[model samples]
Target chain A: MKQRHYKYIVPILLGTLFSCQKSSNNEDFNQIVEANPIETEVDVSSEIAMQVIEQMPSPLEISAIIKKTGLSYNSGILNPITHMENYTTNSQKAINFGIYATDLGYVNMYNSSQDAMNYLETVSSLSQDLNVSHFFNFELLQKLATNEQNLDSLMHISTQNFEEINDYLAKSQRGDLGALIIAGGWIEGMYLACEVHQKSDHKSLREKIGDQKVSLSSLISLMNAYKSNPDVELINKDLMKLQNIFNKIQVKEHTRESKVIEEDGIPMYQDKKVLTVMVTDDEINQIRTLVIDLRNRLVK
Target chain B: MTLKRLFISCFMLNSFIMSSECNLEEFSKNAAQKLAGYTYLKTYKLDASKEAEIEYSYVFSNNTQYVLTLAHELETTDILVSIYDNNRKELCNNYDKKGKKYFQGIGYSCSATGIYYVMFSFKNAKNKCGASVLGFKK
Candidate 1:
């Protein structure tokens, strides 16, 4: 009886020791990320894809252009800040975050601090939900939102944060979400431009809308990389519809004259190609309608 | 159980790993200061290779004023920024016609609506990591 009891106790002790050893090994493996990480084979295509995505212009530029037109703030055109709860999925949250960010930039351009706060709150909540809030400086943003006089600082900080967030997401292997954020922002921007065009006749603004044809094509090609994602595929389908309208807008390019000019005693090289957008009012109307429909689908 | 303890310990250690190695935040903040009065547009990290030229393809709306600035860890290396048109023709490099190659930035008044490429590389030594920022004015 004594020998049998000893045998049972020994086996039990051995089992617990082995379990502890295995756990320790697992912990060590996890800690390797902090140590000198082993460099994995670089995926050139994926790297190129991220580079292209990051290369896309910030929507704030478009919003600033819109502001330059002296248009009044149309809160109805923006996605409601209260719709924070509506974005339940990761994809929806990411896309709406982009929409709200563009809206925030627009509001900042107009010096609408009160409206900016609401949009900022919605954006912060979404960022937190997506676990990318670390990249955003909420405190600084809040301070800027309250102080409308510092509009330039607000714009700079907001744009920089978004780029950082995109970088972090791409580095973390979430490039698909980064692509969606860009797609969402670009669509919202084009929608805003088209809406403004619908209301007023600004030739530059119209040209800006037509010029987005190039951006839209680039965005679609980027989306194609992540077409395996159902969410991305659906967005591509909607954009393709918009693309069909964009295809009708013709852009004629002229030969670039390369020259160097002296400005302020500094030699400035000029090698610019002039492109004329030949888009009619009817096509503009089509773009406006389709953009509104697509934006509605996204925000809804 | 020991497994539970191990999981917890691993998570704690993983947090340390996530703290960041390059401190891009501090670098970006410093870069933002250089772009004063101009609304920031985008920031990029410079690859640590002199021979590795990275081209960023973007669209500059017609008649827009834009500027691009490059920042680097001065103790380690320097960066060169350049811009090109859709036809891949060199528009301007930070190195001016007066033989100034150390300038870390360039400004372009975009007069056309088309794709533009902003390329970056190191100047002296290779593998000099840095950051670049873009801003625009109306």
Candidate 2:
């Protein structure tokens, strides 16, 4: 009876050991499979896939387009959309404005030159084409070449462009239309001043471009000197108005857009918000003062 | 018997743990050094004028044979290039032409190694230009 009992227990223990070994091997195989990186082959629909690929942005091509636009603008073959209207507006507004302003400093400046007045009268008929205020400045510069009386007014007008530009810049963020317009006017003013300096051999006018810095006060001073007639009280009054406006400007920073994200913490490209901007109120008073100063210098 | 088996198993496990710990320090040290040495360089502008002299220095490894480069949109109407050895002895001067415009030519001998200088001189020019340099090593 004892032998029979031992034999049964030994067989049962052997069977249990074999079963445990099999379960351990199965667990090990499962763990190895789980640890390996799995790659799934997705069978994309050719028609849909091709359409999606075509719609993706090509960075190289986009950059090339932007470069071409810049080149065209630089070459003057294509007037930038930002200033196209200014080129077409009444040319006389510029001539009249320039001559009248300059006369305030030196009455002799416009004595023999009715050329600017004539040009202004001609341009007034086409005022609809002018896009920005600087277009008027350009005409004024052209008239100033013949009419010396336009110098003080030209200075007042050009200086106002700078003040208005700074105001616009203060109110808007970088890359905005306001910034582009301001840059356009600044370039126009600088270009005119450079041309005049080259033609007349004016050392002071030439020096204006040398520093490469643009400020309201500096521009006002430049205009004051270029007027060249100390007897003119109107020029002095305009300069003071410019100073008052520049002192009151203030700027504020703000975020204009926010990004959208996916539920899994990944950013969604289509929902990306770009462009940060800051606005200020201090420059507006300067702009108003500049405009008033320019008008006062020109109307008289 | 049970105590002896348990002790042997613990001893084997301890040995495995200690060996892995030793390798971890070496791997981390190498990673830290590599991260510390990396850097970035950017070029903003390069200008050459008739009034201003151009100064340049270059180096080559033992196997380097030849170097070729191109300069475009030069501010000067004419460009002249001169190469010199470490002792300041003149090596060669070459004139490069593209259509009606002339540029600076760049070339070197294979047997030369160490530091060499190339000077570029120009006259009456304007606008921004680009330069591309290509070198061969043995």
In order, the candidates keep a fraction of the true contacts of 0.48, 0.00
TM-score of chain A of 2: 0.23
Chain A alone, TM-score per model: 0.80, 0.23
> TM-score of candidate 1 restricted to chain B?
0.74
For A1-300, candidate 2 gives per-residue lDDT tens digits of: 000000001113434431111121112222322222321111112221221112111111111222222222122211122332343222223323222222211221223344334333333332223333443455655566465655444433433343333333223321122222222233333333333333453433323333222133333322232122232224435545645643543322233333323222211111111211121223432343454445333323
> What is every candidate's C-alpha DockQ against the true complex, given to 2 decimals?
0.23, 0.01
User: What is the two-chain DockQ of model 2?
Assistant: 0.01
Q: What lDDT tens digits, residue by residue, belong to model 1 across residues A18-44?
A: 111112111221122222122121121
Query: What TM-score does model 1 achieve against the real structure?
Result: 0.78
Q: What's the C-alpha lDDT at position A28 in model 2?
A: 21
- Every model's Cα RMSD, please? 15.0, 33.7
Regions of candidate 2 where Cα sits further than 4 Å from its true position? A1-213, A224-228, A231-233, A251-286, B1-50, B53-138
Q: Candidate 1, residue B3: CA error in Å? A: 48
**lDDT tens string, model 1, B1-138?**
899999999998887655424555566667666775567887766554433566676777777767676666665566667787766667778775457445656777776766787877776743356677777777
Q: Give model 2's docking category.
A: incorrect
